[model samples]
Target chain A: MRSHPHHHPAPDLLLAYAAGSLNEGASLLVATHLALCPHCRAEVTRLEEIGGALLEGTEQVAVGDDLLAGVLARLDEPARPLIRMPDVTPRPPPAGMPLLPQPLRSYIGGDLDRVRWRLTIPGLHEAAVPCRGGSVKMMRIRAGMGMPRHTHNGDELTLVLAGGFSDADGHYLRGDFAATDPSIDHRPVADADGDCICIAFTDAPLRLTGRFLRWLNPILRT
Target chain B: MADTTEVDRLNGLLLCVARQRDRQAFVALFNHFAPRLKSFLLRGGMDAGAAEETIQDVMVTVWRRAGDFDPSLAAASTWIFAIARNRRIDRLRRDRRPAFDPDDPALVPDPVDGAMEMMLVEERAALLHRAIRELPAEQAELLRMAYFEDKAHSAIAQERHLPLGTVKSRLRLALARLRKAMSGDTLGEQA
Candidate 1:
């Protein structure tokens, strides 16, 4: 019964997650957001079932020779049983830690202060996390600060962790999921409150479109 | 394609494996699921020997973890594929930074609960079959490439010579329609 973000991830992104086709970086963002949003988790589960249902209708292919024999040989000897999805990941990040979501805690090893933030611009900082498939960074923006107007070289998925931000489309609050592809043009500005913290994943670096800032695009390494 | 009786029988087989270390029941489960799992892995362009290896690994894991099965939470097919999918992910893992683990503990998918409400395979399969049948041919074909072939949207777009946005939106619409049907929030509900 926890409160959810007003802005949910696009159904297409969720579908990709359910299909297990999304890359690791984007998948990390989606998983982190999902830990906070029950509705999205339900949708993902529903999509998984739908995927399973689709599997039921597929024409079965014959297995290679020795498939059954090989499986039967291993009947007495089994490898370590799989650890189910829920068993390994710790849930409920204590009581007071509002800033750290479930997926981030393990990545940062539970120490929020240890995050190495690089000052990318005045009042804006970017901390890159090690992830596969793409660049995933945790971005912090001061209240009332606005990023340069921009589009993207690839898709970008940003999951707001704390405070708020807004773009031409709409406002995004904690746990909100916002995804934009290369085709989208937006200038995001922080809300007039405390600073905003969000994790953003992009397959390709962001391209700043503003006249002066466009020159900074290559150095931004977004 | 799964009839009610077939689903019932498969359900019973899994239940037996759970209650007892029933090798015969295990064989039944293996026979039914292994070929499909192999085909699935192979179609994703995995080599035949590797696909066989993965399928064997999946079956072994299924037997090892059968005791955790709960009929109320998931159908036998759902549970089986959940494990298969996870195993597949394990094989596909690249790099070490841990991008995301769907197997993470707290992110358990919504398991359909309540014995009365559970139909396991039969009802869901039938509804899903009809739903797929009803999807626009493009969407249906895309769904097949995605769900079964395990192709990424980018690859699908490349293969079909379509824009990535079109692939995503079409999939979104197709899934929305199926979701409505699966939840029983159908067009009939308005009547």
Candidate 2:
């Protein structure tokens, strides 16, 4: 089994998520984090209650008389199929597939086995995860390989999916969430024990600062 | 009074709709929530017709999904608010709301005992309602903009002419205070 996360999303990010104000990529990152972290899940649940209270506190506007009847009229119509919540018991991953969580799994179209990896450098493999207003990509770094030193111009969020990585901030295990901005400049190296795989969400392209990798920035653009 | 009893009644009404397919109970649920939802959407800048259409969709989903409601897990209003929030996001072409499946196997199970946790959530719910109502006007306004305006923090900073850090800090402060208030009561009870 994968290890639990030690790091978490920031409070502001969590609040934005509970308020449903985050863009798709950020929201996707938070949702995946929530799936892995029960504490944040509880925090989000409480935050959502605040939304409920705000919703309840709104001044009531009398609906048109016809509105209720219209909704009621449709009650007897066939229920549209919903992508309802799954059952309570755990379901194993598809045979031979890596254990990928929901929302992320759905976004990726399958588990890690399905990823069509492109070799970005000698040891780094990346597969783009489609999202608007930002870039989401799954990265697979060979054990002991280090990413080029870089800083973000806009916001970037990374969730560790498997193995581990360590930078100046700290080591991140499966389910750890790291929120990085322009203020942070560090290079993360995959753990030597195994290949480190993670999904990264960035609103702007990262500015690579390594002497040799600087020119490779264009290839990294979302 | 909108106290715990009112909260329970709403939960019970939804359950009635779920178990018996009781139209009267559904009507009760709709009457209480629909008008509030309409006002909320309008405040969020949706047109009246669209708000009405969205409300129709939301209420219908509530009816169909009522069986899924577990008051111990979430209050009735909270459940409905999530539905409305998702529907609004969809109607607005605001970014897709990525959602985690609650029952996913990778999910870390809550470590606390279920019954004890439920009690705390119930207690927190009451405290949260009061805390929000009593919050200083500036903080309350920020919350409104975040929810009703559906603006990102950067957008809010731009519109309010506050620095981005200030917008983020104030929001963080507001939530921190609300959380402290909720947990304070629980701490006191334990003491």
Candidate 3:
């Protein structure tokens, strides 16, 4: 477990998360962030209290006469665990700080060694994370590597897993969350000290806004 | 407003089931919460049959995971509501709800030590229940739509024909009021 993270999800995102209204990709990002940020987890806990209140206050419709009996009958049967065990290897992650947190680690199917990274360009590698409703991708940028300038066609949420990255908005270190929208267009470069690994959730493919990459955007669709 | 006694009673029953695996205690809990869970799931648009099935599943989970519930961290109602919410998400949506696994090594520990902080959280739950009830009608209604209907704020804004910012601000205002109400009591105790 790491220390409290400096960057956090926006209130609306956090609220949606607490409400259980966010899609899978977004929820994954928030859950991973929540693992690292106690403040947000507390906020979520409070909001969930509201959900509890609403559940209590809602009009009660008696369940079927047989429902309780049915439940009791099967109480002794083996049940699935609350948290699903994603198919993951037992191998420990690489030495030092873990790049992928729990939930995210399981979602990625295992540790960093298990990730099958493909080169998007020299010095930059990308891997698609399987999630429904939107796209999630993990990226690894070599030290001092700068991504092509781009703007989200829809909102993009990035959680820094290892090392750091900096863009027009600010520098994002491990566990820091950065949310970008179509309104913000800028290139992000990895900190010079180490390779930066981050997972990003995007509702829509990014539009490469860099002057040179602009023409290739149609073909890349990333 | 939730009666503290009633809340405590439910908490005790849950604890009994947790500690003794007492069938009688589980039965009492199932009776009380099953109806409420049914109502909650139906409100979210589940068909009657589906809601019933989900309630049974939820109740079974309640029985199984009773040991995991900590009264200091959450009220019984709040904990059950979360379980129902996650169950609903799984039943209704194609996407999985990714949740933090507490046992994961990468999981960050709460900043404050557990006991005191968790107790404060329980107190906050009671205050928030009342605070929600006390929110201006429109804000309360918006909160319901966001939660029960699982509608996005943007969707709420469109449905209400109001600016998205207006909807967000009202919700924010409602939350701020709740926090203020909760802090009022805590601050008094501290001073």
Who wins the DockQ comparison? 3
Error of 1 at A149 (Å): 2.1
- Per-residue lDDT tens digits for candidate 3, residues B35-122, read 8888788878899999998888888889899999998778899899999888888888845788887766777777555442424544
lDDT of 3 by residue, A1-222 (tens): 346688889888888888888998999999999888778887887788878878877878978888888999989998877534444565665466565777787787777877899988888888999887789989999999999888888899999988999998898988899999889998999999999999999998889988788776775575
Worst 10 residues of 2 chain B by lDDT: B112-121
Off by over 4 Å in 3: A80-97, B112-122, B184-191
RMSD of each: 4.0, 3.3, 2.8
Compare the candidates by TM-score and give the number of the best one: 2
TM-score of 3: 0.91
Order the candidates by TM-score, highest first — what do you get?
2, 3, 1
**How would you encode candidate 2's per-residue C-alpha lDDT over A1-222 as one tens digit per residue?**
554577999988898888877887889899998888877987898788888888877789999999999999999889874333322244356664346788787777767787889998888999998776688899999999999999999998999988989999999999999988999998999999999999999888899998888898998874
Docking class of 1: acceptable
Query: Which residue pairs clash in candidate 1?
Result: A85-B103, A86-B105
lDDT of 3 at B152: 77
What is the two-chain DockQ of model 2?
Answer: 0.62
What TM-score would every model get versus the actual structure? Answer: 0.87, 0.92, 0.91
DockQ of each: 0.41, 0.62, 0.66
iRMSD for every model: 4.3, 2.6, 1.9
